[model samples]
Target: MNTPGTLYLIPTVLADDTAAQVLPPQVAERVAALSYFLVENARTARRFIKSVAPQQVIEELSLTVIDKDSTEAQIQAALHPVAAGQDAGVLSEAGCPGIADPGAELARRAHQLGLRVVPLVGPSSLLLALMASGMNGQSFAFHGYLPIERPRRVAALKQLEKQAISQHQTQLFIETPYRNQQLLDDLLATLQPGTRLCVAASLTAPTEYVRTDTIAGWRKQGAPQLHKQPAVFLIGA
Candidate 1:
């Protein structure tokens, strides 16, 4: 039996133009060494690889799609090369793979097959947002996305606020870019006026914005232009 090759959990830049500033040189080195990759989007993954290693031939790399809808058998097939001693990488559409991304399933399968799983350092919007939020970092919870419906979303926000106040924990969540403004509106309406709300948008980019203020303060300042920007929302005591 051949030694199983490693499965690298590669991280990508949070913003399109901040790759050089956010990703370390080691990320490029590791990506250049691998020929097989499982990515959420092949086009973006190819673009990211090209940005890091300009000399790399994109056509030579085998990019496989392992998205939210990927089945168990499909994931198993994607890992076949790694199990046969060919190193493979998993890339997310943005930030670190396996966090809120579908790459987690692949990593879980890799562990089940006894293959080595190594995570490469890179920018994660969630961590960056929390780091700058001035919230209770030691006790924080990340809820990937809130309910889409108005009633459910409002209920979820109220619950998150309750948790933050009772446990002194920072409750973090994200919304689809297009629905960012709607979520913010709901948050302001649902959370208590004294609760602290943080909206971190376009992190790691030149237009990055991070602000933490009480609900009343936010209302006074008016809603930010978060209509279609990548953002993270946090509720804290």
Candidate 2:
């Protein structure tokens, strides 16, 4: 019987152009050795793999798509190659897999099946933003994406602020790129004047911007024009 192959949790660069600046050499080496991958987007995955391993034969690698809409059966089928002794990797569309990503399901299944799972280091926008935010990093929670409606979004912001204040923990979340400016407006409108808010926009990209300040400070300085940019938002006491 063939031995079960190891499952590699590969992290892709946060931005397409920042791979050279953010990716570690070991990550590329690990990616180069993989024969198959379960990725969020095959096109982006191919582009990313080629960027890291320029000499790699892209067409030779097997890829299966695993997004938020992927079913359990599809996830299991994707990992079948690994169970049959063919090494496989999980590549997220951006940053690390399994953190606010659908790849978590794949990793959980791999563990249940007793397959060896290895996570290689790479740029994680969440951690990077937390590190730069000057907030309480020791205690933090990532609440992925707030509500879309104004009333619900405002209530969510208040709840997040209360949690941050009461527990003295950092409340981190993200928004759809197109709604970034609206979210910023909502934050300034709903949050207390003295409440601290950190906006980390286009992280690891040429247009990267990470700033932490009170709501009042933000109003005075004017809002950052962060429309349609991948960003992380953090709030704390």
Candidate 3:
């Protein structure tokens, strides 16, 4: 007999209490209270937990960290207790817990066991950037991060761009913070001149920036100094 667990949705973004940003006060509070947390990246997740609760020493708590590389049976074994009656926090290295981050399967298991899932509100670079992209928001696709290889990545971008324009849909994606500049360079060199690009940087942070422009316009203004931080990108016809 285990205490039934609650699946809390935590986003890494910092924003107001909007539907788009549901990982702030609401989610963070529960995560801080939960006796156990199942995070994607233990090291990073520990750091974040500390940031949100300065007094809490996460390493001392009963937390389990899992990743895409983690074993399914191992993860399932941990959830056994939470699904019974304990509260568990599912988190990501950045952004939302289940978006682009691992934990989709764990969430399914929690649901099957009749656990209550609670989602918090906060920033989501994806929705925030797409809303400001001025692209066809009505029809859009989030293809996750593009390939790192030059040729394949460019070809993929071209194909997606073509499909978006032909179908009047906006193509959205993201990338590792450090490699963001490289991705931008590839887009600039490969995409057509008239294509529109939107970049949302440090969303909800003090130095947050949102810019939309054509490849030529961005090149002339020089690339933004994003450093190795999270950001979301959008491109359209």
Candidate 4:
């Protein structure tokens, strides 16, 4: 019999109508199949797990939860079982785990240990924004969370905007939920009025919204009322 050392990281369904992903029953089924899970947020992981099988009764899940904050030793110890045939399903607060998010470092550790890692289906705001940005998706880069410093962030945005417009290679990035407004503020300050701006907010959620317009139009809308919802910010020259 094969041991359960393998791990799986799945993606959530994108909120786009034309998105190529699904959720609910399938996600639940996949979670049910896992002998153990390494979640970025145990609360979210358990909540999602509960939502999937609200009626079913589980004696001991022992998914071996872990988050972005889990230490390296903790990650390695968690993977030991997966590498030995004990399956661990890694998940994020939402959407897919790993990618530009956490778990990649842990997944890499698993690989170095000769353990098999499996990723699952899920939503990704990055690709979703790219698809709708109307820009060249042939080549792109996710700069992750930009700098919080004013001068540095402005310089960074200016350089990226120039690169996107001149090279047409497409530049993708995101920011903290609360800091999104400030980031946009800085983006407008640095970039010109003619530049393109795309904001994809509350992706895959009830109040989900997407908009692609020029910096001037965006400014007229006055900063977006993100409050405390998830959103991705994209811009091109």
Number of the top candidate by TM-score? 1
User: How does model 3 fare in lDDT?
Assistant: 0.76
lDDT of all predictions: 0.94, 0.93, 0.76, 0.74
User: What are the per-residue Cα lDDT tens digits for candidate 4 across 73-184?
Assistant: 8988888777667767787766777777677877788878877777765667888778877867887778887888888899889888988888877788888788887887
RMSD of each: 0.7, 0.9, 3.4, 3.2
Give the clashing pairs for model 2.
none
Overlapping backbone residue pairs in candidate 3 total 15
lDDT of 2 at 196: 97
Q: Please provide, for model 1 over 1-237, each residue's C-alpha lDDT reduced to its tens digit, 9 standing for 90 to 100.
A: 899999999999988788789888899999889899999999999998999988889988899999999999999999999999999999999999999999999999999999999999999898999999999999999999899999988988889999999999999999999999999988888888999999999999888999999999999998889988999999999
Superior candidate under lDDT, 3 versus 4: 3
- Candidate rank order under TM-score: 1, 2, 4, 3
| Shift in Å, residue 29, candidate 1 | 0.6
* Winner of 2 and 4 under TM-score: 2
